[model samples]
Target: MELSDIRKEIDTIDEQLLPLFMKRMDCAKKVAEVKKRDGTPVFNPVREQEILDRISAKAGEYGGAARIVYNTIMSESRALQHSLLGAGKDLRQRISAAPKAPRRTTNVACLGGAGSYSHDVLQALYPQAEPSFFSRFSDIFRCVEQRQADLAVIPVENSSAGSVSEVYGLLMQYCFSIIAAKTLGVHHCLASRTGRIADIRCVRSKDIALMQCSQRLATLQLPLSEISSTSAAAELAEKDVGIAAVCSESAAQQHGLKILEPDIQNADNNATRFVVISKEMCIPDDAQKISLCFNVAHTTGSLNSVLSRFAAAGMNLTKIESRPIEGKDFEYDFYLDFTGNVHDPKVLELLCSLEDELPRFHFLGNYCEMK
Candidate 1:
């Protein structure tokens, strides 16, 4: 077919698709009503999978790739269906729900201004809470510790990269409790006002952002200068010539910088997990995770014997970190978390056992799952 003819045919098909979409949604509403009447679940993963498979098989008969069209249509259909009724209501019902919103005057602090990873995490995790930004991680920690901020989000570890050693050490030093935690994917970008990569000379960012973008920066072999934070880097690049920032998209937009490259981290699957800290323990109703720290005896198999109690109780440990006992020779403190709640008998038994085994220990706190 001629190009114009193909365009004409596509336009005609799009017009036809509008009515078909309406008709399909009408049918879905009927299905919702029927399910409601029968007290059946609104979302059925098995049925969704079947629908995708059936549509993909049928779409293959047409000109384009089956899976792509199938996924797009299925996602829209599922989303519409969910809106009509509710998505995954049964599972939500089973969950002991938490507070619907952040407490009044719930001030939160993290490492940056407006568009850093800490800011992004604050937005995603809270969505409704008021946030305060800081340049230093220690400042972020101090805000919560001193009651200047009600809570703080501090990065602890990454999947692609290893642990954030600074955050771990700070956690040990601070008297805050790990009230909540979550993981966010890190999507680094090389941003500058100048469009061309060759125009870039000095690169600026936080030490961590610089580390994350080390591979990309190494390729350029430019003089690397460290800034206080990613937001600070973006701020500098906004006013300076021949400079670029390794920062988030939001930061680039805020500072009127352009992204010369996206996802420039050394590891493709880079992610950083953060902990929500508070001076006083305050976990929501739907809390599923607990973090604790304790001092174990300076003896062989002491740590192992304590961990065995959790394993025996069928509790899964998410993390175990050890920090040196300063000024004390050969003594070590351990931080650990497992599946069961602090209120649960199994966990209580383990805690009691740990107290008996270890000289000293403290419960950091239990926290609600973010999502």
Candidate 2:
């Protein structure tokens, strides 16, 4: 057959597909009505799998593509069902009713003392708030958990060294709401009282900090110890001439140590992203970022289905990371950061769908992010 004839036939098939698609969608709405009347959930994984299985068996060589098409169509069917039944209405109301954050919070917890990078974040956002510095990341979480502080400002990721895994673990453990985030430039320096690289025998800093400066630390041939924070390392380095701390220049100055070597981190543009966590959810009018953690079904295409919802909504996913679910052996929980204000109708609907359908779904927070 000629190419033009094939195109004409394809056009004819496309014309036929539209009416069939409409009929299927109409039937899907009727199913929703039945489900609503029966008080049944919108998502029926078993039924969906059965349909996929039967279709795949008949489609032969195009099974995978056929499965994808049905997945999308069925996903849209579920979406319509969810809408008709007003799924996530309660969640939407609660999110909409969240109180706006105060103009100034009174108490704040951070992971370092004096001149650490976390302190810089604190100074930028909550300088007026009473600052309680903790030695460990867990301590910061505990401080908030115990209501000793109103909020905890802690590092979540570094530009070069990657995520602060311990902090993420703590976040999962505590399940606090992230209210805001900030990113600050990092400039790691080898600081010591001796002010001499030759005199350095040991190096100490936060694990993330040491990792950021691993290349520089290798050339010095010094033993490294993981300390609570970069500032604490500087404090330790100040009292011992043989120890050097990989910390910010400001931290060294605060602890009466001199900067022996400056800008030692691997990346010139190294930065750390910090999150301000609170016990309550607060969505400001101008909020533009959302953070959530949850697990999808341990089945094929489950994660893809969840991601597809976001894509269909025209939402942008900025970051995603997985950590082992504490007791679930090899299974994991995913942490996702996406760009959307809860006030947007489509965004709210998508979030509600996720809250309703996903397992262990936690709407961490919808908040404004700062650079």
Candidate 3:
């Protein structure tokens, strides 16, 4: 047969499959009604696995491909059930009960001293708020938890270095909600009190900053030392002779150090994303994004099944990151960022189903995305 004839036949098959798919989805909706009446959860992993096994066995040579297709179909069916049954009604109500707008005046906590990137972003996000600086990331969380600060600004990820694994771990430990997020362009500079690169014998900065500027530091042949933050490094460089710091220009200027070399980072377009976390949940009117953390069962296809929930809802997943669960050998917790407001019925249903089905799940927050 000619290629065109084959294509026509495939099109005809698709037309026939459309009604059958709709019929299956209608049956799924009915199943959801019965489940709701019986107080049964929408997700049934054991049954899903059984169906997958049966279909794969029937497909024989095409078992792998068949499993993929059926998996997707099953996921869609679950999503339809969730929507029909209003899966996340409680969660949706909770989110809707939150304040419509964030407080105008608040106390904010951020890592590093004056003029640091965290400080700069915090200032931009909450200009009228009181700011407290901390030496450690955990300290920021502690301040918020203790009610000493109303919100905390944290560097969650760097575009060049990937996700800050330590920050993710801290997030898992803390019960704070992420109310907002911002990204700042990063430019590293080598600064010193001497105002000359020739007199510098050592360099100091945060470990991540030092790594970002490794190539330039190596070229200058200076020994690198890790400090609590770039702001602290600037302070050290200002007080000690024969020492230089790799930090933001603002930080160097704040500490009265002269810039010896600017834009020293290996990547020209380096940037870091910061999250504003608060003790109370607040969903703004313009909020269009959500962050989530979850852990799936250890069974086969468990992770895929969880992720399929999002795809089934037609939600766009902007980011998905995994961090090892503490003391759990090979187990991991996943962090997900997706584009959707919790107020959307479909999105809320998906979230509700995830909360019900996953071993562990957290709705980090619903917030606006700022670049």
Candidate 4:
């Protein structure tokens, strides 16, 4: 066919498709009416699979594409049915009962002391809040859980170091909600008791700090050791002339260590994202970021189906991290963050649908993330 003729044929087929899609939805409404009367469930996996099988058999070369299209049509049909039946009542109720704004108070807890990155974030976001520093991540979580603090500001990820797995684990264990988040620019320095870079024989810092400056450390050819925090490593370096620490300039200053190298991280854009978590759930009106944790259904294509729904809703998913579920040999739980407003009907419906469908899921929180 000529190019113009092919374009004309495509337009004609699209014109024919509109009415067929509308009629199909009208039929779906009637089907919903019958199901409501019979007290039948909305989703019917067996019937959907049978229809898919039948359609694929005759589709020939277009078999895979045909299945995808039909699958979407059926998904939309089930969604309509769910709406007609007023599904997701529990989650809706929870949202209605939750506070729209987080409580502003002075009891804020975070990991590390005066010059730690977490401390920096706490100062930025909750300057007026009283700070309680802990040596361990769990200790901070415990403080919040026991109501010793109103909130916790902690680093969840670093741009150069990747996700902080220990923090993720503690977030799940504590079951706290992230009411707000902050991302801060980071610049690392190599500090030691002596201000000479040539005197450094070994380095010590947090694992994340080590990784962030891995490239610079590789050239030094020094043995490395892991400390609990960058600030703590600086403290140790202040006491030993041979050992070095990769930490913030402020940390080295506070610990009385001399800076041997400044800005040692691999990337200039190195930054850390911190979350202000609370025991209470809050959905602020300005919430543009939503965090969710979920375990996918075990059936084949289940994860694809979940992600497809997000794509269909036009949601911009920004982050996804999978962690092994404890006590389960190979099962994983996924932590996802996406830009969305729960007040939007489509967004709310997507969350509700997933809550009802996923094997395990938690709406961690919805809040405005600040830079």
Candidate 5:
């Protein structure tokens, strides 16, 4: 067949695909309604695993690239589900379920601009919160410490990368509690003013941003410069010539930059988890978890002893982190998150026991269900 004939056939196929895509989205929306009614989580890891396996099994039938189709479809499915359950639900709801009057205005401080990932997570988690943006994580924490900001959002860990040690160290010094938690998928790209792939000179990004895109960047022989953050890199590109930034799409739009390329991270499954911190304790409705930090006595089975406390109380522990106490060479403080609100009888009993046994202790916060 002639090339024009082939193009016409492809166009016809595209016309058919659009309707099917809309049908799929409609079905996805129904799924969201079911989940909300049943109080079931929107994300199903087991179902996702099954889909991956089924796709891999059919690799031989799709012209030797079965894995590609599986991945693309899985990604689309996840994105669709996320949208249906997240902002879409809010839009669909008839009432303006805007947040209740802040028990007190939570002046939250976070790294970067209005549309940065941290900011996005904050807005989702606390729609009524009054957010204040800071250029650095240290600055964010300081705002909370000085009462300039009532709370601060800090990235603690990533699924692809490991724990953020700097934040861990800061946690030890600050008198703040891990009041809440949020996990966000990190989708990055190489954004610039030009669409051409070859007209790039230097790629500017933060250290973490570069590390996330290391494998992809290695494929292209270009100069790499480290900046303060992904947003800063993007801002720099707006003022400089022949420069691009490895930043999020939200950041690109906020900085008035265009996406020359998208999804340039080394791994498609990149995600970051952040913790909300505040100087004062927060008690919210639907509270399920209580966080505490303390130092164990110098003795063997000390860590085990702490774990036994939860077991004794019939409580489940969610997180445990140890950090070195400043000015003390060997001493360490352990942070713990366990099931049960502070108001629970068993939880109160556990706290009383820990106070009698442990040397130092601080209660972070009892977080309510954000969903």
Candidate 6:
């Protein structure tokens, strides 16, 4: 057959395929109704696996390609069933019903002391709020969980050193909701009471800060001490003439230490992203970003299948990271951030589908992004 004739036949096949696809989806809707009535879950992994195996066996030499096609079809069918059954609707409703604006007066929790980056970002994001400082990140979460603070500001990731994994683990442990997020540029400064670099014999700061300024610290040949935070290190430097702190300029100023060198970090464009977590969930009117985490089956292409859902819905994913599941040797939990508001029907449908189809899933938050 001529190439043009073959193309015409392919087009005809697609036209026939569309109606069959619709009919299959209609049957899926009926299956959803029966499952809803029987209080059955939307996803049946064992049955899905059986169907795929049967189809692939019948497909002969094209088994692999056939499995891929059937997987897409089944995934769509599952998503449709989830939406029809109103899966995840309650959480979506709660998110949509949350307060549109944060309270004018709020108590906030932050890691480190008065002049750390978390403190600066918290002040910038919530200028009027009262700030309670903590030495450990866990304490920040605890403060919000116990209602001692209305919200907790914690660093989620750093542009220079990648994610703060401890915070991610704490997030899984805590029950608080992330209500807001902001990114702040970081500029490390070397501060001392003597106001002279020559007087410094040792440097102190948070371990991450020390690492961030390793190139400069190596040149100084100073012994590094790991303190709880940059602000704490600055406070230490204020009491000792020979001790210098690797911290923010604001911290040195707050602690009455003179900055001998500024912007000493290895990278000139270093920044840290912070998330504001509260006991209650809230989705503001201007919210345009969402964060979620989920686990897929250990089978091949499981993760890609989940990601394809977002792509098919025209959602733009901003970030994706995988962390190993605590007890499982090779299994991982994927954390994802994508552009879409909870009010968008496509976004809601995707979330509902994932919640129903995935073995483990969590809707971390929907919030506005600030740079």
TM-score of each: 0.69, 0.95, 0.95, 0.92, 0.67, 0.91
lDDT (C-alpha) at residue 354 in model 5:
56
Q: On residues 1-371, what C-alpha lDDT tens digit does candidate 6 reach at each position?
A: 99999999999999999999999999999999999899998888889889889989999999989888888888888888888888887677777678876553378889888999999999998898989999999888877778888888999898888888888877766646778899999999999998998898899999888888999899988799999899999999999999999999999999999989999999999998999887788888889989888889998668867887887789999998888888998998888899999888888988987886788888888898898
Q: For this target, which candidate reaches the highest lDDT against the unseen true structure?
A: 2
Compared with the true structure, what per-residue lDDT tens digits does model 5 show for residues 66-111?
A: 5544444444444445544453332223113322223455678888
RMSD of each: 19.1, 1.7, 1.6, 2.1, 19.9, 2.3
In order, the Cα lDDT scores of the candidates are: 0.73, 0.88, 0.87, 0.87, 0.72, 0.87
Per-residue lDDT tens digits for candidate 4, residues 1-371, read 89999999999999999999999999989998998899898877788888888988889999888888888888777777777777678888887788987665678998778788888888888789889988799998998889999999989999887999998988776668889999999999999988887787789998898999999999998899998888888888988888899989999999988898899999999999999889998888989999988998565456767777888899999999888988888788889999998898988898887776577888888899999
Show model 6 residue runs off by greater than 4 Å: 1-16, 58-62, 103-105
Model 2: colliding residue pairs: none
TM-score of 5: 0.67
**Please, what are the lDDT tens digits per residue for candidate 3 over residues 173-215?**
8857889999999999999998987788899999889888888
Worst 10 residues of 1 by lDDT: 89-98
RMSD of 2: 1.7
**Candidate 4 vs. true structure, TM-score:** 0.92
lDDT (Cα, tens digit) per residue for candidate 1, span 119-144: 88888877777889887778888777
- Candidate 2, residues 202-237, lDDT tens digits: the string is 999999999999998898887999998999999899
